[model samples]
Target: MLVFGPVRVIHCVAMITRVDTYLHSVPLSGAVAEQVGPFTLFRSTITWPYYARPVPGSEATITADDIELVRARCAELEIPLSFEWVVETCPSLGAAAAAAGLSVVEHPLLVLERDDFRPATADARLEILPTEDDVIRQARAAVNLAFGEGGTAVGTAGPAERDANAPAVADGLVATLRDRMLQGVSVAAGAFIDDGIVASGNHQPVDSTTEIVGVGTLPSMRRRGLGAAVTSTLVEHAFDHGVDLVLLSAESPAVAAVYERIGFHQIGHAGAAE
Candidate 1:
């Protein structure tokens, strides 16, 4: 609310709420390859809508021969691709996304640096423990609160307290992760407010990168430093590894502001393609 400078809506986020439109309505919907001119265009609805992995120099092809040839080759391989400005994490495919008329959607990070990240109530003790029980229980409670009952789905849910619910990693909707690590419970912390698990969050570590996701606070604990404290602890935990940058997406602008105060920038948007 007070952290971000101003909100920007280059596109209406509500457009893709249906969960099946883009993958079904678009021309290239789910086609492995589409024949257009000499180019065989491929398509897929994975990760972000406009995400891609391009073949270097090959992606730089502006000439009819190479460009068209690569398209056909890609089609033969049944590879579907979406174009986003490729990062170094990607193969150095020269502006293929740009060549395809895609622009660099700002990948935001912490716009500010370290500031005093204190909780609203210092009376309660916030402790981080390496386990998933707290996160799971809080997640279940949050889900129940967000939805009426039996609505445990994840992602841009109507609002944590409206009628929808928290967006989970799908396969493990009740499982708490994207991978198949059978990640028992989880590694997390519990924030005690007044008394009991008033706030809970989980920070998962992958190799060297860690993301402090699975944040949930009791209804009575809303608008407090519980989320901030849980997040900051994980951040400091990640910093122990000398992490250059920590990134995560926030659906609520109000909460995003809190992260901003702790130094997080809006890195554009993340879309779920049905």
Candidate 2:
């Protein structure tokens, strides 16, 4: 068994492989198609153009030609292509993207094992809610506001110019979240204040590992440890239900420190190009 940081590694191949596969498999409104070679292309209304690397068990070398192919596709769609990969496993991919004139940023990868996770002492009105529930609207709104109000997470492209509450964009996001929840690929947790969601998160289970994402507290409600509480709530629920591992990509050093208090340790680094 391979060991990384303080926990026995759960997804040994690469964190990017696992996360990309999960996103590709999930039901989304946009285009999800496999390209030539070991690559997957995703174009969605709610996110930047995603170019995923080869799935595990495939030995495909990504070359400049592959990058150009992806670039061409993104160009046709009029969207910026954000190619992400585990820096430890695919340095060549990062190099290729750099040579192609895309800006690449490397960030830390964090992991928490069930046995190793240190659960927080108290829960702050955390509830696991389905995406189809009435409360989901508020949760979705909270996520959009969090990302829009805060700086974009590391390894992720920034949101588009339009505000999240714009009618058409909001509708697309709501529909996408509903589909994800109804399909059982994702579960959401929220911290409520007087029946309204103030902080929210989503966890997507991929095989034995679950990826915790979208954990955010309302801007007005920050500084009370709500973000930490919400993240721990998601991880604890997954582990209690038998998830072997949970992983997340920390957007910055300060964000990484927040998770470290919840018992996640840095395992590796991931690079994103836009």
Candidate 3:
């Protein structure tokens, strides 16, 4: 059930962040856990892999040496290092991270309260659907209308666009997204009225926390409440599944405002430590 740990929404951050340069999930076996500074890292594959704290720790402050050790380990593994955390700031630590030439991945970390969440307006006939092979194809067509041809072109892909910079389609990724959907962690809806998949996103489930991810609405469909409806529909389903904490990262206050109307609160802004 642990697809991707510490998943912040891949909204506009997807445009700037490649921290997922690795894949999702760890191997069934325990990932190698090590200590660097005060932070702990759990890793499976060495090169460009996903990692997180092996376990929560009580200590908070870390020394410069601690950061250097963590970096040295990442270098040993030949993998790109990323920050998996939540704190006020990391000025010194960020500088250390940068001196190592670690690729910067900044984001506006977001969270939504389960109890306070609600959709803005119920104008659209929203539907909660599963991920499918054809879903990407449908998403492409719908996004063309919603986000416009420029930014939404990422949807034009259907399996062939996985790692490429072209549109957002990829064959293997589509299959993966489908599996995540069936796992009850992903969803995409076709807008017959809108004429395509006007909305699509995935839920990265960690323990009981579910982060609404990959949430995107077509530009043509903007201001019609489709974004809020699609997101609300997904949150309702997550609640039904017994998830209590729903979080996502948003880049724009406009987008954040939609989630705000639905029962989510602005917990804080999460960006680079520096």
Q: By TM-score, highest first, what's the ranking?
A: 2, 3, 1
Candidate 2, residues 1-274, lDDT tens digits: the string is 7536633354545554565455455424445665645666666645434565544445456777888888787788787677767666566778787888889888778888876777663335877886563567677666666775674233221122112443334555577677777866777888876666777898887667787888876666666666778888889888877787788888787788888998888767867887
Model 1, residue 102: distance off in Å is 19
Backbone clashes in candidate 2 total 0
- RMSD (CA, angstroms), candidate 3: 9.4
- Model 1 scores a TM of 0.45
lDDT of 3: 0.52
Each candidate: RMSD: 12.0, 5.6, 9.4
Best prediction by lDDT: 2
Per-residue accuracy of model 1 over 129-222 as CA lDDT, tens digit each: 5335334444445534532321122333222342133333233444433221144223466576444455556654444444455566555455
On TM-score, the candidate that comes out on top is 2
Report the Cα lDDT for residue 165, model 1: 32
Better of 1 and 2 by lDDT: 2
Over 4 Å off, model 3: 1-37, 42-55, 63-65, 89-110, 121-125, 140-168, 185-193, 272-274
Q: Which stretches of candidate 2 lie over 4 Å from their true place?
A: 1-31, 43-49, 55-61, 76-80, 121-123, 132-134, 151-169
Any residue pairs clashing in model 2, and if so which? none
Evaluation by TM-score, superior candidate among 2 and 3: 2
Which residue pairs collide in model 1, if any? 108-267, 109-265, 131-186, 132-185, 132-186, 154-166, 154-167, 154-168, 155-167
